[model samples]
Target: MKTIFTAIFIILLLSACTKTLDIKLRSTEPKIVIQGNVTNSGGPYYIRINKTVDFDANNEYPPVVNATVSVLDSNTRRVDYYKYTGVNGYYISNNLFGQVGHTYKLTVTVDGETYTASSTMPNFVGINQLDFVQTKILNKTRILPQVTFTDPAYEKNYYVFSLAVNNVTYKAFYAVDDRLTDGNEMVQQLYMDSSYIQKRDFVTVILSSVDKNVYNYFNVLQANSGASPTTPSNPPSNISNGAYGYFGAEAVSMVSQSF
Candidate 1:
């Protein structure tokens, strides 16, 4: 009877220790996150990787590590691969970022797990007509440029417009307010009223490059909010880098007009 009792006690003690060990192992595993956006519409693009916070807790952005990006064009069958740059968990590539009609895909490996995503290049809506004129707001001089373009209207589409002035060395400032279409309020205001102003001597406007996913997000928002950009419930933080930066995407837009 004594031997049996001792054996039972040993088994119970081992079971309790095993549970504790499992909890400790879970705590030590790394918490990581990864996100990316096209910084420029030009050939060279950057994939930004970052880590998310612990379960609903606020945490600083953590850059991703050891991630690789491979791009293949559907029509060209051309392949390009990018290696992670040590700066801010970014992968840099000059030749593989995007092309007018090509499809792009991304795959990531982290923590012994693999994640995959793909996006097709949004149609490049060249600006057939662009101009900037003077206007006044609040009795103060505010430079505004009015842009017009025909929507290609794909099955699912998203668009971003970028402006560059002077040359590649210098940048110009302006805002789209929202997407453009026929006879919308913002578009109407841009044309009928003297609301448009010129901020610079000339500026080049190009359509923004986005995948079908982001396009669907904005398209739905536009249908609900009209052409006006909605008021932000939670404004962005001091961090000024991501997709929301001043000139978030590339400016390789070839369309240009002189004031």
Candidate 2:
């Protein structure tokens, strides 16, 4: 009798698993996507503009062309104009260069719609040294780059790191806040998804001092890097007027090593 009851329960469970439900998804209107940055490294900064596409359409984002772009130095009240480069909605500024401790405001007008955003360049911080150490993960040995720096005292700070291997930029995002390590020496380990880096591969690491907003943007982006499109939400943007993506003014320092 007990065996018969067990068989009956199994059959009921199998029947429940065979049911399927169709889910209908609704489509929404597209919005603008803006990605712009100004670094303390140099001039000739570019901003890319595009419109978001439908959910089921190809991943091609239509470039927004003929848009007027300009940057303003908030302290000096000087505006520098940008010309559309006629390629992929990129706008280039010829005269404006990012300066540390200066605030920059970006203005964009497209098809009678306007968007604005602002970012302040943080103070420059240089990396003290860089080294590589070997470690075992998932039963495999991998060499990872490590960076050391002294965090400034009595101030809140945020940072972003990028790695380039063999002169090709890796898309991995690394961001950190000095909340815990403030006023102390910090040693950070940098990683990549692949473990195929050899001793002959050339590597470059960039350390950028960023504002709190940019730090939060990169934090959310890194958290949702490998998530499904339907499962994860978009990263928060600094751009106003219902736009997506971030505008950053950052102080950058870099170091390179062959490993």
lDDT of 2 at 216: 87
Compose the digit string of candidate 2's lDDT tens values, residues 1-259.
5664344333212211100111111225678877777887776677778887766666677788878999898978889998876666667777887889999999999899999999998988889998888888889999888999888888999998877777656667588989999899988898778654687888777888889988887887777666665655666779999887778888887788888
| CA lDDT, candidate 2, residue 54 | 69
Candidate 2: lDDT over CA atoms?
0.75
In candidate 2, stretches whose alpha carbon ends up further than 4 angstroms from where it belongs are 1-27
Look at candidate 2 and tell me the lDDT of residue 14: 24
Q: How far is candidate 2 from the true structure (C-alpha RMSD, Å)?
A: 16.5
* TM-score for all models, in order of appearance: 0.53, 0.86
Pairs that collide, model 2:
199-259
| lDDT digits (tens) for residues 1-259 of candidate 1 | 5664344333212211000000001112244333344322444445555654433343345567766655555567776676775665556555754455555555555656555555555555455556565566769665655665554543333454434444321221222323444223222113223334344555545555455454443344334333333332211211222221111222223456666
Query: For each candidate, what is the lDDT?
Result: 0.42, 0.75
